[model samples]
Target chain A: MDTRERLISSTRELLWERGYTGTSPKAIQERADVGQGSMYHHFRGKSDLALAAISRSAREMRDSADAVFTDTGTVVDRITAYLRRDRDALKGCPVGRLTQDPDVMADPELRRPVEETFAWLTDRLAGLLADGRTNGELDPRLDPEATATALVAVLQGGYVLARAAGSADVHARAVHGALGLLTGDARRSPSGQENR
Target chain B: MDTRERLISSTRELLWERGYTGTSPKAIQERADVGQGSMYHHFRGKSDLALAAISRSAREMRDSADAVFTDTGTVVDRITAYLRRDRDALKGCPVGRLTQDPDVMADPELRRPVEETFAWLTDRLAGLLADGRTNGELDPRLDPEATATALVAVLQGGYVLARAAGSADVHARAVHGALGLLTGDARRSPSGQENR
Candidate 1:
């Protein structure tokens, strides 16, 4: 690969591992095996490199989701496919992780790619839900946009809970719960029932 | 406060701003206005200081949430109180933010406090949902533990989305959406169904 491409790829990986504030120019240079001068030549600094990396990551995320969002299937089928798609769950979402970085959040240019990626996901999911309603796969009363937002939040938030607990079980359980809600067969324990 | 307390507090603030990987002992010392020898005199090193900070942060977070969770009110009232509780929304959740730190995730010592905090939160929230189910305030079919996990995920994930977008609107909307689902009025949009 070219130097610029290697730099961008390295930045993406580092950003995922360390976030914007945690990642440094020297680390990027070392990871890319590029000299400081070369990195500066390609981009102004860490933020500039991060902007490129974030933009690239966002594009890749959108493209991957687009494949599922545009697939010919029921809305549940599509959403399930998207959710169940193989992922490095423990590593967390690359684009989603950027949101926690103060430096990234502070810079509009750095934050835009992350923002647009989620906006696209929510809008696409909403559109799919709209289709589901029209096809009688979902209750017409379901609000597509709001449900769409909740759907994405469930996945993203699941990761946080799982990571914090150092286990993927909570994340998987939450995903299952959300899917169950969507499918209308939500599970309940007797202990839970007694509260009602 | 004592020097040790000052150091822990300073470490907490720096950790929040720069994360585990980015925060340095020198920075902590500087922030605390303590000399290098003074810091090293009290703690072994950066990791030691970080553990203290994380543990303190965890306790603070639990105390903050406990105030809402333990309130004598209906389930919805408690959840809503926690949800609408005044917050530096853009700054994000202190304990929740650690989930994004690779360094913290890699170290069991650093990760334990984070794990305990979320685990406690889930258990606390699940109990409330259980109460709601028994009181007939929620659908009997809902899984309290699973729903509790989802509820926590919404808040964490909302911070991610909101921070990424540099706008709290999406976060607020997502929270409202989850509440609607929990309350069995999931069909309504943010505009109170007028948009539909």
Candidate 2:
């Protein structure tokens, strides 16, 4: 990758690990293996670089969600696929993690990507649920928008539980529990059957 | 308050806003309105002060949970009360927020109070759920531990969603949605409930 791409990628990684307040421009340069001049050549400073990185990360997250939302399957199948998709459970959600950073939340420009990503996810999930209800695949009585918000909250909060306990097992259990709540009627066991 | 108490309270307030990485000894002293020598005289440094602050916060959170857990009421009533308790939702949960701080997580001493607080909450909630199940108040097949984790996750994740959206309405809606799911009943509209 070129220096500019390398710099953005490195910044994204650092931001995930150390957050905006903890990450330094020097650390980004070191991680990218680029000189100061090369970094400055591409972006104004840390904030400028972070805005680019966050925007890229947001796009990447949205694209991943879109893949699940548009999959040729039932709503449960698609949502199950999205939840059970390969994830670094211990690392937590990249976009969700930004919500906890005060510096990131303070800047409108820096916060836009994080805000937009979640808003988009909630809307997308709500649409999928609405589609399911329309097809009679889910209970028509279910409120799509509320259920979507609850579904996303479970994943984000599961990370907090896991990280606090220093165990990803808690997160996995929470996911299993939520999936059970969503698909309980189809299964005899408390743990829901794996989605085909 | 004594000097030591003043230092701890100041640290808690600052940690809530700035997090561990962004907080410094000089800033802490300035916020506490205590001299450098006075702070050092009471505690070794920022970390020491933070440890004391975290311990205090954890204790307060646990005590708050204990009140709900020990209340003589139905499990749903108690849980709802805990969920609806007044809070500065925008400020977020101090202990939950610390889980996102890399520096705080890295220090075992700093992380202990946070870990203990969540652990205690999980156990307390699980106990209540178990009681409900045994008394036929909850689903017999429900896993107390898993359900407790999900409840806690919902609350923590609700804060993140609310903060990101810049509205506590989403948080309240998410909480109500989870409660509805737990009860396995649709929420009645105000008029419908009154008529019933």
Candidate 1 has what TM-score? Answer: 0.89
For candidate 1, write residues B17-92 as lDDT tens digits. 7788878888998899999999999999999999999999899989999998888988889997786566665677
Instruction: For each candidate in turn, give its C-alpha RMSD to the true structure in angstroms.
Output: 4.6, 3.5
Per-residue CA lDDT of candidate 2, range B1-196, in tens? 8888888999999999988988989888888899999999999888989999989999999998899878888987788777667666667889998988888888998998888898889888888878887889877767777778778888888788887887776676667666666656534321221111
Q: List the lowest-lDDT window of 10 residues for candidate 2 chain B.
A: B187-196
Kindly report the TM-score of the first chain in candidate 2.
0.92
lDDT of 2 by residue, A68-160 (tens): 889898898998788767677667878888888898999999998888888899899889878887898776666777777777888888888
lDDT over C-alpha atoms for residue B33 of model 2:
91
Considering just the first chain, candidate 1 attains a TM-score of 0.92
Off by over 4 Å in 2: A185-196, B188-196
RMSD of 2: 3.5
